[model samples]
Target chain A: MDPFRKAIKGYDHDRIPVWFMRQAGRYLPSYMKYRQRMGIEEMMSSPDVIVDVTHDPVDRIGVDAAIIFADITTPLSGMGLRVRFLDSVGPVVENNIEKSGISAVEEFDPSSFSHPVLKAISKYRERYADPLIGFAGGPVTLLSYIISDGVDRDLFRVKRMMITEEKAYQAVMTRLTDMIIEFARMQISAGVDAFQIFDSWAGYLSPGEYEHFVKPYVYDILQELSGSIPTIYFSTMTSSYVADMDLPADFYSIDWRIDMKRFSAEIPDEKGIQGNLDPAIVNYDYALHEASKIVEAASGRDRYIFNTGHGLLPSTDPEKLKRLVEYVHSVNL
Target chain B: MDPFRKAIKGYDHDRIPVWFMRQAGRYLPSYMKYRQRMGIEEMMSSPDVIVDVTHDPVDRIGVDAAIIFADITTPLSGMGLRVRFLDSVGPVVENNIEKSGISAVEEFDPSSFSHPVLKAISKYRERYADPLIGFAGGPVTLLSYIISDGVDRDLFRVKRMMITEEKAYQAVMTRLTDMIIEFARMQISAGVDAFQIFDSWAGYLSPGEYEHFVKPYVYDILQELSGSIPTIYFSTMTSSYVADMDLPADFYSIDWRIDMKRFSAEIPDEKGIQGNLDPAIVNYDYALHEASKIVEAASGRDRYIFNTGHGLLPSTDPEKLKRLVEYVHSVNL
Candidate 1:
């Protein structure tokens, strides 16, 4: 069995499964070489390019799993929104979905929307022996990007809709949840071994708001996907809500702000846990030593996956990341 | 006694003390009127202007305490860095302090540095009857802005230095703590009633990293100032570190992420707890109802001060804020 599968099953393996989020992107110099030649929209929408970049970090850093190369907004284009990846500023929607525009958001049909991602997943699965992980933005997170220009710290427009137009907000969230389910199912059918749901902006909500507005949809998505394959629920900057998050996925991915041991104690042993390492540590001089501290903290915990609390930063050193993987493998688990 | 003083003293009053972070900011039209005329640097440096802007929110919104209107980076100007508040981008240093430039960081003297802020505090105290709250940036947060151009989310350079150049990082932190102590003392001596230390970026550290790299200096600042008057140690996005913080302050101001009831249960009643309504909720359509939810959560808690978890946003409606204050004061505590 693959190391990722073994770790998820809670079997005693010689080494823990390890993967860094965003491992395939800008951090790798080779990936940047290709990125310079094409725009983000073109690079992500091409199956051949997606497969190449997806395989880059695994080839260079030797991580345990290979996540498919695709942006979360890949499906948004088919949903009647024009997504643009601007410089300095990140992914922005040229046309934002207001309450009046809610009727314009069509249900994302997997066959028509994001066919390139599915094709890339199918192609990459044939090439790589390691577990192929699939991912999509959580429903509310994707809604945040579509309704607002991009993921906002304040989430002003998102919350205003949630407050002022409750019916419309629910309709959009429900549709997005259905869309994510369809998207994840398509990736799973394409031979992806596991799935990760990235709820990056869920931290902006109050616990009450999260429970009322966000949790049910998240629970529904995990429930739909859990029986099919291992599902990882990753929410950044939402550590305070962990104890209250009753969703039972195979793995819960934590951010660096919370202690791994404390987080482990809160969840059941059968469930797996991945990440909480600060990605910024790689830009520093003591990357190796700092990575070792995370390793020590995670040791002896059942089903713990070695990964960063957040995505690997754009400026991450590939050599440092390679060293980190070597060190994680060398640890006596 | 002022309502703010009553709450801090753990005394029961007719109404709870109400204040919002960034109460005197761009949200007010009156502030923008002055800001349009003079630049941010010039406005902050002028005592007459600072006094007027600081009074705007108190007069318009009817809050209890008056936080002096000044940027946390106000003293960074005196420490050999030139500060500029750009139009779109917030505060930026014209010349950011780099690792190679660490030697240039100088200790701030109250008499020599930030004299304008002290002058503003003195002038405001004479005009206002409400307890004056003075504040300065915590060592790590100020260090982050100084080393990096602004408050970086990734905190790449800050983390790198903490790992690689440990001694230089320590030197900068030590001087910053001393400088903050000196800067805050000047405000207190100038007749401010209490002090708040804003460790806004400390949430980026792991518990161990926080305890190792950030906590000691924070503990020192609060420890030194706690005897003189109430000290509020406010750190944004760091509710998970509360148990491990071990840094004693008279009141621990938390962001809206944590449950207020749970937070109050964890801390002592005599030690006041301020804050934690999500500032974004103010922008919502049902601002009053949402603000009431926060009030309900904090209803029975002792020594609770009504305030937003973070600073009020620039687009936040002053009328909504005024109504929230009116509702908070109307509640039977």
Candidate 2:
């Protein structure tokens, strides 16, 4: 099997198919210079720049996969939502989704979504030969910005919608899921090696709601991708729901908060498992030196793709990450 | 048994010992009216108002327990390094910790830490006469905020400290642990029914680091609290580490991402367990109705206390919460 295929099988690759959550990030001095010169909006807007930046870490650090360098909110930008990446104040929106916006949802066109993404995908495919993960925000996540009136700490606004305006919430979920299905399908058609559904905040859903509101749409998207592409389904703090809900993805990248032994035991034998190391462990110098021990602690007799509980922070030294990579390689069973 | 004592023992009460993470807040009309009258700065300053608001939910919502109303950043506020809650951008610290702020560390009097908290205890002692949880930020949590450098999407600044400056991290950790030890001690001293260490960010620390930097101190704190207070070592996603480490905690509050069957199985039976609910479930229209299903799922367990995976969001409706309460009460073991 292809190493990438082997990777999705939960098989330990010859050199552990390791990739940082945000590998193409500020941690790369090269990317910093690009950010300084081009600015985030300019880079995101230009497919050429997106392709160049996407390959920055793959070619440089030599990881197993090259996730397309794009923000989770990329698809939603077409919906007349002004998502501005204000240097440091992460992906800010001018208008948080209010009842006004929800009622007017049909007025927006899917074509209005950003064009640079398609251009970037076509271009990035040409640049990096490794598995390129095409991903999108889960339905509820996109709906969060809409409900919070902007960005909120606990997503109270949307949660309220779940209780009060169940139909509106369902309508929003249907819309975002439809968008993501198209978004992800487009990537596979464009010849991306593998696709992963980045449900970064999916764990927020109860199993029943996840199954009702989310899984069907995600399953639809995966099917639209033609199922030929090896796919990874990832979420944070979602151990309970995923166990009960049958998702068709090849891997589940969970946060480190899960009980690994139980997760390993319960998740169906055929599926792949990724993640979840404590990203903060990098903060402990001892952790940098002892990554192998950490892996050994979480490892079980299953296909485990070693990754962090969450994204690697900006402060993580390249040297520590390098050490972590070597550490995972050493432990690949 | 005293309901508070039952809370410590991990027994589900007749009403199932419910308390909202931030029970008293902007959501309540009464809290808003009181807070508006007193002013925001004076709200935190005056123990009277804080205590009154702490008891507000008990009077209004009929929650089983009342958590002391306070900010996670309260302890760090006194260091006089210019910490204030901003109207638009919550919790503004004008001064990010340089080495100079560390100098002010010695001036911190841990005994005085819980004085206002004691005042809260005195104020509400006879009112509800149930479990009154007193909370403080745990080590890594304090490190995340006390030195609020930037958006800690993944706790980078603090993790970098742990990696590069073990001594510095330890110094910070020791001070925080000492302060918390003092804080928790004071809460215990104040005749509060139980204690909850809000290690909201504990899931950020990897297993090894958690075992080293976090657990030992937690063990010591629990050892010191030593059967006096029922403790809940609650965090978002630390189940991976909690399964491995031996901490002297009476209970664990798990995130909803974890499947309860696995969580219940993996977490040793020596201590009681609470939580592992999907917060998004709370957002569903039949949230309380669905929550009863969740409680029913976990109902057979002898040592489980029911709660959400995390706290309620600011926008969580009173009706949904009321439903959750109704459902938990309706569940049959």
Candidate 3:
């Protein structure tokens, strides 16, 4: 069995599955070369380039999994939204769906959407021995990108719509979840072994708000996709909602705020756990020391995956990342 | 006795002490008039201006306590750091001490430093019967500003220094705590009723890291000043550290992430609690509804202070703030 697959099942594997959240992105020299050669739109649209970039990090850093190289906002573009990745500003949506109104939010057939991503996953799977992980933004995060301005913008319209326009909010959430389910199914058919849902901004909502607005939809997606593939829920900054999170995903990928020992005790052993390493500590020596602390915390747990609390920052040195990966692989749990 | 003081003592009061964090600044039109007339530094330097701005929210909104109008970084200038406030960019430091090295850090006497702020406190105390809150950024936050660029900057140097340069880190933390003690004493001497230490960035560290690097120094400051004045520790982000916090403060002013009911149950009733309405909810009706939830969460506790989870956003309307304040004041419980 694949090391990533075995680890996700809470089985003792030959080696602990180690993969950085953004191991496939800009930090690698090979990725930078492609980025410079082609604009973002061109590179993202090219399936062959996506295959190469996704494989580059796993080859260089010896990670246990190869996540498909695609932007979270790419799926939104599949729904007919005009999305652009600017130089330093990150992703920007030309036709902000929030202002366009929720009535404008229509579900698209994921089988017909984001062909490049599906093609990349298929190609990567043909070559890679490790599990190929596919991912998309959680309903709220994807919805926030198009409707609300950036993550920090007072989620005025989104929060207000959640209340005043409950029907509209429910419609958008249901449509996004359905599209997400389709997106996951497409990736699974494309030969990916796992799926991870990135709810990067779920921490912004209060528990009651999350329950009312986000949980049901997230659970709906996860419950539908559970038996098909090993589903991982990457919920950031919402450690306080641990007890309240009733999602049926196989794994919960928490951010750095959580205490792994306590989390393991609270969560059932059958469920797997990944990450909680602080990505902000950029110094190589400190990162290694912190990684050791995480390993120690996660010790004795039946299922544990080594990864960062968030993405590997652009400024993060690839060599440091390699060393961290090497260190985690060398740990004898 | 002042309602704020009575509430802090966990004594029964005629009304719940309602105050908002970041209450005095940009949200009010009267405060904006002074801001438009002079730059931030000029306005902050004028004692008469600070007094008027500090009282404007109390006069307009009828909050229980009057928080002194000042920036958390104001004291860094007293430590010889070149702190400046720019138009859109908030606070900037010309000679960022982080680059200057932690060895360059020094403690300054608050008695002779920031005369305008002290005079403002004195002036406000003479006029207002309510308790006036005096604040300083927690040691780690202040140290971060001088050493690192901003809150978002990868805390490479600070995190590294915490581990590698322990002595230097301790020196900086010790000097910061000392200076904070002096700053709080100055405010206390000027007749402010209580002190609030804003550890806005405390959420960045894990429990072990926080315990090793931050907890001791913060405890030292609060312990030293315990009897002199009611010291409130307003820690942000790290709610997991609630079980670990050993600081003896009159109140722990927590952010919105915390569940007040759980927090109150965990903490002793003799200690007061303040805060945590989410400021991001922009709709007046929604804010009031959320405020009612907070009140309910905080119900049955012997002592509770009503306030926002964080600072009031610049976009938040003064009218909504007034209504929320009015609603809290009218609550019978």
Candidate 1, B112-194: lDDT as tens digits = 66568889888988887878889999888888787866666545678777778899899989989888888878888998888
DockQ of 3: 0.51
At residue A39, give the lDDT of candidate 1: 84
RMSD, every candidate, angstroms: 2.2, 4.2, 2.1
Q: What's the lDDT of the predicted structure labeled candidate 1? A: 0.82
Question: Model 1 residue B100 lDDT?
Answer: 35
Superposed model 3: Cα runs more than 4 Å off: A148-157, B148-157
Selected candidate, larger DockQ, 1 vs 2: 1
Query: What CA RMSD would candidate 3 show?
Result: 2.1
- Cα deviation of A104 in candidate 1 (Å)? 2.1
Q: What DockQ results do all the predictions give, each relative to the true complex? A: 0.67, 0.40, 0.51
Ranking by lDDT: 1, 3, 2
Interface RMSD of each candidate, angstroms, one decimal: 1.9, 3.9, 2.3
Candidate 1's displacement at residue A77, Å, is 3.2
- State the lDDT of candidate 1 residue by residue for A210-304, as single tens digits: 88888999999999887898899998777877777879688889888887767766677677888977787865545566567767767667688
Better of 1 and 3 by DockQ: 1
Q: How many clashes does the backbone of model 1 have?
A: 3
TM-score for candidate 1, please give it. 0.95
